[model samples]
Target: MNLRLRSNAIMAVAEQLVVGITFFVLYGVLIRSVGAEQVGILSLVLVLTSVGQLANIGFGSALLRAIPMHEGRGERHLSIASIETSALCSALFYGGLLLIAYYPFQYLITIQAGPQYAPTIAAMMVPATINVFAMGLGAVSTAGLSSIMRNDLRAVANIVGGILCLAIVFLATPRYGVVAGFWALAAQSIFVLLATWLFLYRQLPGLHLIPRRLNRTVMRDLVKVGYKLQLQSLLVMALEPLSRLLIGHFGTLSQVTYFSMAARYVMQMRGIVYSASQPILSAFSYLRESDPARQQQLYATFSTVIGLAAIAMLSATAAAAPFVGELWIGKREPLFEGFAILQSLGWLAVTVILGSYFNAYSLGFLRYNLGSHVVMAVANLVLGVALGWAFGPWGVVVALTISLVLAGLIMGIGNARFQPHGSRFLSLSNMATLALGCAAVGTAVAGYHFVRGYWPMLASGLASGVIWAAVMLPAFAFHSERGLILNLLRLRIKRRG
Candidate 1:
């Protein structure tokens, strides 16, 4: 990657890390203040409200591809219209749906959460609904900024919004409880929505918050691409909520909190790669027509780096679960620790397949992506029911892990057909990396089971990480992109000096 692309990737990662850390702190506070059962109720409500994303009908995702391609072709007007039309459509549709479904959803929550927690959850959904709707508006701007290679601006908005969220959660949770947390989320979403639009307005001169006209051709083209994603969203949106719902139905609400918290931890770790890889989609889209060779190169580079990095991070997280769990929740909950470690392993498998996902989407291989989700949904349902029945909450987690592994394999195999000749997904180097990474994770998990005490667990985790780095260094020393990345770093360091 060139310096500009590298900078954008760094900025994107920075945004996620900052926002994730801030929210991590907020959740810690929430758990402490409101207790786990209330947080469980909060998590359940938020997950249900997240279905509001379906209102977008994949227009937001289409914008990520459409805006970049249009801008690259010098059709700024088309980009503007696409953004406005998508935001308007999503907000209105979601708003109407929420109004119609409010009582039914409330009844569902009442059934799921029971009478004691139902009122709080019902109230929380009000702000949570606004939060999701704001997200619909902000998703469009977020896509526009990313497509234009200005994630740095999105980073700025997110940092400020995260701080705002933290302050609200910290102060208000003490007085008002779980509803305060939803209020904070709503506040942060609106802040980000406004900030993102301001950034876009400054970046694109002809941009307007309101649309002069919605272009039929742009909307139609976006719908053509987005409709598949819309269908896919049904399965995609169901995955997490399904997990939580099953846990709640089969186990206790506290298990729901633990699972949700553990999943959040794993997701934040995965966010590092997900954020850095966001620009890969735009880059691949840009290169699809102009440079197939460069597109192949980009895919290989990201796949290697992201795959290895994801494995290493998740391995370390699994090993250090004891320390991380205690530190995160202010005490040791063996349930949460178990959930974190197993969820880390599951997400680790999914993270390794992210490059293939970007490749498929950028090249209009939507069927591959959709097919992967179908596999995920089926596996999660089948394994989740069987395993969950057999082993309780941990069984549910195992089911999730197994499902992710299966889905990832499906995606990888499907996308491999699209790779250029001689550009294989599992090169010798990648296989070696995966093998070694898996071994390290196995060692870490085994050691974690035997090792006692926080310091010993942390030391074991560090030792495993060091050994893995040492083993990988020989391979990276001769890797192709190493020289470019090193040279860029050296130049930057010298320039600073």
Candidate 2:
């Protein structure tokens, strides 16, 4: 089972990379043809999205938990009521809030871009906000699918959406400007909403829509689950976007420009592992420790494979960062020189990967550390803003790195207490090993910058990724540590034979 989980993690990462790169590549092309001014409204719209997702408050996680268990245990009606009731109410609430937010978008625009772009920005936020609401209609179900690892279906929808969005951006954006991007996004939302509903309805079949007689029990359950997750949502909201806001205000738009583009690639790489981790982490952490073998299952599944894959990818991306900024964005410019923020926040990627199970352990036991998540986010945001004000973009970067290290440490302690029986791996030596590896990989890649030409540097950086992965894989796969995993697989194969 651990072997399967590891394999699944790799496949999911591969799919995410292929699908995500398609979208980013198209976006890069569009940005090249028509500078950030033409389609930059998307970033502002993303600001609203970050808020809207928090507003979801873990409805997706709760929905995922409810449905499959109910299906397996034969509580179809209850499951249907839970999914639909949650989805419809979520849509109504977020949609209306977004609509109400329209008039005030001028305020948001003024904060970000000042009065000159404020009016046009306000206009764009309207459709984008509505699209956000439309997304709420389907997203809970998708989250459930992801939790169950039935994300092959969701991934298909994503791939399709990415392709459509690419065509929409290229064909419409250049001719129509930023408005085309918004309109295409709205259309894309409509496409996915229909797809999500159809998929869920087919799977559940007896699912019904009961707007008039809302199930109080289902609503209560949703709240029970969402409240625990709300802290996570809130913390993510406060911390994730602070750097951008800080950079935009204190530094030049070009600084915000370089950091934003570089950060996107970094974030996307981190996101692939995160996507795979979320679902399985929940499932594994819930296994009974009375089953000692299952404890080993958790370690083999998580520490051995997932950790190595994340480290390898992190190394590859850190090495390739300069090439992405200098050549990939289409023009050779000094935009590649200042990546301190990118490098600093890159540490968070490791924290995110190593600390993957921290939240799941808390939530699985119903410890509901919303207060902790909120506290960490607030501390990070406050420190980030203060430092950003004092020192500029680097300040925010430094603050974020400090915050994540503390956050990861805090969560590591809490998670150990939450599940002492599992084969826990958040020791000081382990962290030291990870840090040393990051330094070595980061230093080797830094040398590529001295190549003095984009084309040569890009080629070498790409090749270096292969070299690092080759070295990391054997050190991991043949570990004396997981001798049992190798033996168990052999037994299973012999038994089948």
Candidate 3:
């Protein structure tokens, strides 16, 4: 990546880290106040409502690719129209559809989470449904900002919204239970939605969300590209929510909380890296037709960085799982530790192999991408159902873990087919180093059982860091992308000096 793109990625990562940490703290408060079962209900509500993204019909995904392409060709009007049209359609169409589906949605909660939780889930959905409406407004705005390389502005909006969510959830949960979480969601959505539009309006001379600005042709093309992307993502995105549902169905509400708890921590922590890497989508889209060789070079470097970061982060987190769980909820639970460790490893597979490929898919490889999702979704459903039925929570997690690794490797094979000669997603030596890092971290985590409290946390974390630096840093130092990164760092340091 170039210096400008790298800096944007860093800002994006900072935004995600702050926002993630804010909500993570709120979840901790919820656990202390309302108990794990209530937290489980909240998790289910959030997961169920996430399906509302279908209302946008993939326009958000399309905007990321289409707007950038349109702008590159100097079609500013088309770019403006695309954003306005997507936002307008999402609010008008998605709101009505979600409200109409409220009862069925409640029924889904009843079946998945339990009947007793249905009433609270219903109460929560009232606000969550409204939040869905606002999402229509926010989605295009968010995408527009990123496509324009204004992630710094988007990050500001997100951080402020997160703080608002933390405040609302903190103040209301003790009195209103998990329902408070939905109210907070509604508030945060509206705030961020407004902030994003205001920012876009300021950045783009003629941007507007008014109906008059919505172009029929832009809307049509957005759906043309978006629905296909949305269709592919619908099943792929269900992996986590479905895993939680399985936990709720076969196990208990508390089990759902445990699973989601671990997942929330890992996903949020990893979001920093994911958000950091996201600029590649815009960068790739910008260069897809214009510069194939440069695009390949960027992809190779990014893929390596993603893998190394995933290993370093996930391995350290897995080793410190017990400590994290204790600190997160004010107590230690073995299940939380197991869930964190398992999920860390699972997401590491995703981040390392499949990280930038989804963004690459936006460069027009949906057929290959769709095939990978099919492979993953099928593996998840088959293994998840069979194992979940046999062994309970552990079975569900193990199923997810295996499905991720299996599908990711398959995707890696497909991604390689498109690569330039002598470029690989993961080199054999780096792969070996990654394997060694995992093994070292696993050993450290295993040894944590012999110790207790903060000692294990510190020791395991330090040991993982040491192992990563010794093994992984050398790989980075010798890799092809090292020059780009080192040069960027040196430029920044030189400027400071």
Candidate 4:
């Protein structure tokens, strides 16, 4: 690892940590305040927003690639103008969605909440819908900052967004309860939107935001290019939080609370690696001026570290369950024993880390939509919802884990088939081993649950985590380049040199 790359990695980690902390804290407060039904409503808003996110049609990512690479003032202006036009199209799509949410389509969501809570959820559309649009707007700036590698700015923006969200949720929840949380979510989205737009417009003056005369050719190309991601967005939007709705329907709000907290924590812990990887991958995408082989080799290296990190994080999550739950969730007894959440995190770790690497691969290939992403999204939604309904909240978590793990496995199949060598170059052995290690911990936790009940789940989690850490540290010291501790040593050595 070069010094600059090492610094970039660390900064990315720090950026995500700060963002994650602020983001999850808001979730904690919201969940703590309104209970699970409210949590369900919030979950619905997230689902809808996910759909709304597609309004941009991955234009933000498209912009990130186009802006930095294009040369000359003319090229920059055209690209920025392209993005500006895309934004209007995006706004129209979301505007349409909000209209749907308000009228006949409002029944689609409200009916799910039941008559007692239906009206409240219906009213939530105002903030929630607007929030969705705001987030899409924020994507433009986030994509811009990412292109420039302004990670600190990214972190600051997120902190501001989170704070804004927290304030709205807290203040509104008092007057309107669950609806307030959604309102606050909308507020955060709006804040980010405004900030991002201002930053982007200032940064690129040539790219006027004024509506251009319609270009049918440009629209056709843009939509065609972005269609894959749009489908993926739609599918994931539906599937990701179907679990929450399922839990709300089958189990109590308490169950939803249990699942939500666990999900939030897992995301927070994993965000460090995910966020860190984003810019690195983005930079790699632009490194066509450098060696593509070397670029891939580096991506794999990062992926391996992410793989190991997943193991470490999941292990710790397993180990921390009992004490962590006691402190954070209180004694819900049956509502949260922690094993389900832990297992879910294990699945998510593998899914998310692998997905991150694949994203880079997709960008590199400009094969962003081979249909796999959307397929995975559909699978996750169907499986998650079905399992949640069948087995209750735990069912949802388990289903989610399975879906993610499967998606991770499937990501490489096509790549392996079509690579230059006619064979996959990336090592599956390390990922497989790390995966087995995770499975061992999950199984041990599950077994403990069955045999000694939930207490043993906690104990086993701790034991598995400590054992993995101890085993991994020594093994990694000699065998692995990107082991957590070694990465630090490399960073230090580079600084000295």
- 204-271: candidate 2 lDDT, tens digit per residue: 66664333335888888877867676667667665656676777787765566566666666667767
Give lDDT per model, in order: 0.77, 0.59, 0.75, 0.58
Better of 1 and 2 by lDDT: 1
- Residue by residue across 1-497, what tens digits does model 1's lDDT show? 12246778789989989887987887789988878888888888877566877777788888878876775566778878888777777777878888887778878887898998777977887898789888888888888888878899999999999999998988888889879989998999999999998898888777775645566777788889988877787776777788888899889989999888888787877788788778878877766645567677667666666776676677666656666676788776799888888878777777887777877788788777788788888999988888889888888889888877877788878877776542343667667766666676566555545554445645655655555556556655665545543543333110010
Give the clash count for each candidate: 0, 0, 0, 1
Native-structure RMSD, model 4:
5.1
| Candidate 4: C-alpha lDDT | 0.58
In candidate 3, position 448 carries an lDDT of 58
Off by over 4 Å in 3: 1-3, 209-211, 289-293, 354-359, 453-497
Point out the worst 10-residue segment of candidate 1 by lDDT.
488-497
* Best candidate according to lDDT: 1
User: Can you give the TM-score per candidate against the true fold?
Assistant: 0.91, 0.85, 0.91, 0.80
Q: Candidate 3: what lDDT?
A: 0.75
- Per-residue error at 125 for model 1, in Å? 2.0
Residue 341, model 3, lDDT? 84
lDDT of 2 at 389: 84
TM-score, ranked from best to worst: 1, 3, 2, 4
Better of 3 and 4 by TM-score: 3
lDDT of 2 at 436: 49
Ten contiguous residues with the weakest lDDT in model 3:
488-497
